[model samples]
Target chain A: MDEARSAVRAARRSDLHALTDLRLHFLGEAAHADARLRLMPDARDRTEHALPVWMGQADRVLLVGLDPAHDPQGPGADNAAPVAYAMGLLGAVPPVLAAQHVGEILEVHVDPAHRGKGLGDALVAILGEALIGRGAQVLRAAVPSTHEFARARLERAGFAPLQLELERSLDAG
Target chain B: MAATFASWLQDPARLVVVAEEGGRMVVGFAAGVVLQGNGWQIPARLGRITDAYVARPRRRLGIARRLAGRLLDLLYEKGVGTVRLAAAVQNEGALAFWQSMGWSDLETVLERAVPVEGRDPEA
Candidate 1:
């Protein structure tokens, strides 16, 4: 608990178990089905299956933050012990286009107890730097209006609203 | 340089389409996915058109329409009762195109920022 450094670094496959837990903690109850289908399966099975693949993908970058104050082990921190995390795609097409290489924020989540900390901001800056270094020209994020905290975080990180999608009732159609 | 888009599609969740002209040129393409339920109780599938492309010479030949229709049919077959897609705020022509195909607006997603760093202003 000597130095409190919110370092943003590449996430390792070993960290998937904890990341999945964090995702479930934040998104499990309220997230739509697609997210659940994508993230919340048998946790161990999915983590084991997806994490290694993710780590191998050059386009994907998983940034994690550790507060030495909380995780005293420094960089050797465990999967169940992340202070915060940000998962992003380096070359992505916004929802409006078919192209590629647009930086995209896939997921950014911090433990509820760590909400007020600047960990989210640090993670974003790290991700941005990594992305720009890898040739990302434009970065985009898709956040629901209901996610006030995430929306605020993205704006603070310098992202602006570029597109708005609407969904009509199937009954109406 | 390697085609980044093709390499990016390795994610199992993505829906992708591509057309190659007998190994000499690119022709047409489209892509989308059915979003069923991430957590909500909504049982219907929501189709999202992520990418649609057709070479200029292949335009006006019903390629895009067929591609879109094929995606829609795939969604229906997959048990998605409804589908949604988005367009840029200024993409009137694209908007018209979706409308022509029976897709419509959904909801507006907004953004706000949390201040970080620098000197705190006087209250």
Candidate 2:
């Protein structure tokens, strides 16, 4: 557990390739957890292209967890790849009350092999700090209603339920 | 309010409809935006009614309904395949209002305060 916690850190520009793979993995996990989720064929390509832009943004935060014991073989090896990642964006809400800035957790995922450790909590803590540093007064996340595990994690991490998104098909009528 | 209205007016993906009395005084307004569904189970373009307001004096006159109807029509004309709106759970009047207009409950939004560091959690 300690090893896994230590492996987590803020994602850097050099981690783009690993970040892209982790994003695809996260999408697959999301789909498997919910039958309603359908992965776009170009999701991988889009993630690869968008990661750099999102990472470069001042209002965005991305954190990654690496395999604690990963040792590079020589060259072109799958060394130091991220085992998990969490991305968030800072946004401004309509001027209400004393708080205006809100931080939204856009996506978070941990590799199957890295489950059961405290890596997820570590990532959330780091990201929360980053968001607070950026002047966010509140943190928000929209977890899939079907993803109970993810929802549980967020609840345990000091996030409270925000809104229920109900949807119906217009084509039904 | 001015900046928000201006931005919404400028966004091509959004539609703003206003009900005016005597062609000058604004009585009510409805605003909506076209949201592309996340390629999951929801693949169609969605029209989300972000805000709708009707003057209290204009209540029961169907001005709000007319504004919403026109907004929906414009959204559908723009190729939106679905429409949705959210109302506070405690506001039974608003709920009934939307229901009467053919909008059904979708999801309830829950909000939680972020606990400040070093603060008492129970507080």
Candidate 3:
């Protein structure tokens, strides 16, 4: 496949490896750019094990972007391997506020070779739409301050800066 | 708000605390919740300061600080490793207040509105 050809769809069981591959790439890139996200020695093992269980979850949506070069009319239409992936989780804020169901985009990644092909934008748009179909009234994504590309990607996908999350690590009590 | 309070009061993993004064008047309140982490990405148990509010008349009176301290202590008692909270960028007072209480900026949360109809993306 030369370029991604509108082949994005919700991930299936058969797409587990593909999903893990693209997601890991995003995490790896994140860790490379930010020291705070250092990976442990067993990071790959742990993530690999958790991904399959995550794939089976009903409250999460995982999307895959395939390189649609295989036969379009036969069972091989979707046979091409996935070159990108995006995921979202169904969640809600505290009910004290005007509580509404939310879909949070946790990660979106396209393979390096697939970059600049608009695959990332396609994944986010479709992922957001999918989450809305599943009853999400609002959508949110948290991006690190240093990652200009990631933030720009979200902005291009229609996300606007909403809130700043301040954090403090507490001593165990 | 009443329903939410009632539900939080009945949940074990949630912490709801309020400061009272003058024998019966409620001056401030704080809320925290614990979450089960996936162990790989996040810690096993995490805490979040979902809401914290103090009456306008009670501003800078240490009521919110005391409430926040008590709420965080309760979260620590539950074995949480870290705690987080979000405040809108425009809420300078709230942000500064949280900073004084020891929280610092960590992440930027972006939001998008999903229309009720015609959400199907053509791309």
Going through the candidates in order, state the TM-score of chain A alone for each one. 0.75, 0.85, 0.84
Error of 1 at B71 (Å): 8.8
Clashing pairs in 3: none
Worst 10 residues of 1 chain B by lDDT: B114-123
What C-alpha lDDT, on a 0 to 100 scale, does residue A5 get in candidate 2? Answer: 61
For candidate 3, the TM-score of chain A alone relative to the native chain A: 0.84
Task: For residues A54-110, write the lDDT of model 3, one tens digit per residue.
Answer: 788977888888654434345866566788888899887655567778899998888
Model 1, which residues run further than 4 Å from truth? A1-5, A29-44, A68-80, A92-100, A168-173, B1-46, B49-78, B90-123
Give residue A58's lDDT in candidate 1 (0 to 100): 80
TM-score, B chain alone, candidates in order:
0.67, 0.88, 0.88
Worst window of 10 by summed lDDT in candidate 1 chain A: A32-41
Most DockQ-accurate candidate: 3
lDDT of 3 by residue, B4-98 (tens): 78999999999999999987999889999999865445557879998899989998889888999999889998998789888998889988998
**Candidate 3 lDDT for residue A111:** 88
Error of 3 at B111 (Å): 1.4
TM-score of the candidate numbered 2?
0.74
> What overall lDDT, based on C-alpha atoms, would model 3 receive against the true structure?
0.80
Best by TM-score: 3
| lDDT of each residue in A23-134, candidate 1, tens digit only | 6664552354223223334544554566567778887888777653555454555534676777777654443455545666766777777766677777776776666556
